[model samples]
Target: MFNNIFLLMRQELALSVLVFLLLFIKIGKERSNTSILNFVNIALFVNLIIGICFVGKGELFSGMFATNALIILEKNILNLAVLIISMQSFAWLKNHDQVIEFYLLIFTSLLGMFFLISSGNLLIFYLGLEMSTIPLAAAANFDLSKRKSSEAAMKLILSSAFSSGILLMGISFLYGTSGTLTFSILTAHISNNPLQLFAFILLVSGFAFKIAAVPFHLWTADVYEGAPIAVTSFLSVVSKAAVLFTFVSVLYKVFQPIASTWYLILILLAVVTILIGNLFAIRQDNFKRFLAFSSIAQVGFILIGISGSSVAGSASLIYFILIYVFSNLAAFGVVSLVSALTGKENISDYKGFYKTNPLLSWVLTIALFSLAGVPPTAGFFGKLFLMMAGAAKGNYGLITFAALNMVISFYYYLRVVKAIFMEENEAPIEKLGIPLVSKMAMYICVAGILITGLASMIYDYIYSLSFGL
Candidate 1:
């Protein structure tokens, strides 16, 4: 019984234990100048190492939970994301009284995401989904310094609540029709019944909200502009990646039978998302809001892979997200650091930034260029693979529309680049002094962006992992 529950569930169990351990450390008499964020970073890094060495897969809790190679890989990617976010954020949280509360909120949400990513049963997925969304609300509200923090929290939770209702209703419909919560058996039972079709659309809507897909993305830009940069970064990269993977998993792995229906929906959704995201991005002044729309556009590109409907599509999505993690994090890291030092969050404020902060300027420049799909950046290849995967389906018209949208995206992405390198500022931000840990994290991100593009093996390995290549 111990082995059954503990072996495959090691990461989740260990993370739960760490949260408790953190409680003790927070409350214990020992007090010093040391930051708990630092300690948490170290602990999480160790967790990543342990996860890498963990070999094998199994279902736990009577098959409600699953831990497999793909799940582990996804978890590690998330871990890396959280670690970098934490490291870069120490300066922001160092003096806040709710530092313990901050980390707690993060871990709680992360634990929920772990369950969400690994669950084999619908009930377990819902449980994890709630766990993930709740703490993020609190985290978003952590900054009472500004009224918008509270506003962002309210918007996020309300959206989650509505999505939850839709999702739960859909799950009930599925249960009524299929009579099983286990996904492995779900595909066999699901038919083209109108009831089941409605349930699937409802389920897709719930996930679309989470992934910040177009129609459901009303809350994204405002929340991103209002929330703390660290929280916004977490939402943009980590949360989106998890939702995308889970969306892909359920559709590609479990519900391929209904491909005739949902894939068509995704194509329409993808075109709309790309066009709206890019069009809105052109008008954003707040740097975070710009990134918010940028992320939305990127999601549309990811949809191309999903609509492609092949192992290659799934593999390309995972690979693209890996590249995306490094690129987006690096961009946000620079934003966080600059915001901390100068209290500036507008793109216009970044004028003549290169003269003052070369490292940050270059990192942001490369990151944005990569995001724009410029050659020799991981994002370029990421888009290339996604395009290739989409092309595989012989849908020339859809791919052509996607390609044209990519051109529109380049204009907005380079707008930020133009601010950093070409535009001049009367009062440029001074040379910023980032902490060692933040610098290290930025270096890692920059390196990842470069190497992942220059080396084919990086993409090859990710594709191999997803496809057993």
Candidate 2:
């Protein structure tokens, strides 16, 4: 038990210590904020390396903490999120006054995510979720100058609290039905009870709010528009991915016998999320809000895989998320660069942006095309695998609708590309030089999008490792 607790505490301790060290270093030197940001990146990278070395398929703390191949994939994806987020945050923080606290909050949130993904019990999972969320709400309000930022924080807090209430109630119901909160034991106990079915619905609803699935996504646009772009990117990628990982684990491990219930629920949610996301994105003028809707639509694609309820489904979902992290980060990274340079976040502000920053324009073009699921990019292949997973389970209607949704999504994604490359501007925008770290992050994301698409071996390895009941 001591050994398990020690291992569980090690990674988090490293992160906390690094954050404090950076804080002290910042206080002593009065150097450029970039220096502290660099330290944060180094800390996160080191943590990633340590996680790779120490974390593997095993149980800890009497099975309350666990790790496996799937969790390793999750950790790597999150590490990539941290790297991208840190780079983007640095771009914004360079000129901002209150920068150190931003890094501290980000590290705290990521620490919570790490725990969330590795949690073996519902109690730990909820605690981790709240820890991750509360700091993020604070980060949303970090930009004290903007009223929208405060509004976003308040909305997020209110919505999060509501979701927590629903989740707690559901957990109580689940406990009453199964008499245990441990996933392994719950799996054995949750056979065919109607109350268990209701509990599953409530649990999924809570996750739906976290992932910004349709019918529960009212707060996404406001929060994205109000928060800093870096915080928005972190919320979109890392936070959403953590919730989905937990959702997949619970569906496959504890609720496998109730596939029929979740399948219908997931399919309906997918259809609504895809159509509504595309339709709403069509009218959005704010760049962050546009991507918010886009992220929701992407979640719909992920749900198609989950609806299938197979090891293939889990593998497909993970692959899609990995691809999405790259493509979405690339998009947001470019947006962060452009927004920082122009101090503009509106779509119209990007008019004739190509004239000044052709490289960024092209990067945004590629990112948008990938989001639209254009061929030869990672997003295309991610959707392809999801469709295949759905078909494997004989979900013909769901796959067909997903294909149609992809077509609808293309329209809005291409609109952003057109705005970047085709639209002319009356006012000439100044070209801003890309920072080395930011440029490297963008190039890595673009390369990852392409490489993951072309690499069949990686897909095969992931498919083989998925949990099979």
Which window of 10 residues has the lowest lDDT sum in candidate 2?
Answer: 1-10
Q: After the best TM-score superposition of candidate 2, give how far the Cα of residue 250 lies from its true spot, in angstroms.
A: 0.5
Over the full model, what C-alpha lDDT does candidate 2 score relative to the true structure? 0.85
Scored by Cα lDDT, where does model 1 land?
0.88
What would the per-residue lDDT of candidate 1 be over residues 93-120, giving only the tens digit for each residue?
Answer: 7666677778888889989999999988
lDDT of 2 at 381: 89
Candidate 1: RMSD over Cα atoms?
1.5
lDDT tens digits by residue: candidate 2, 315-354: 9988889889999999999889878877888888888888
lDDT values for all models: 0.88, 0.85
Per-candidate clash tally: 0, 0
Clashing pairs in 2: none
Q: Can you give the lDDT of residue 320 in candidate 2?
A: 88
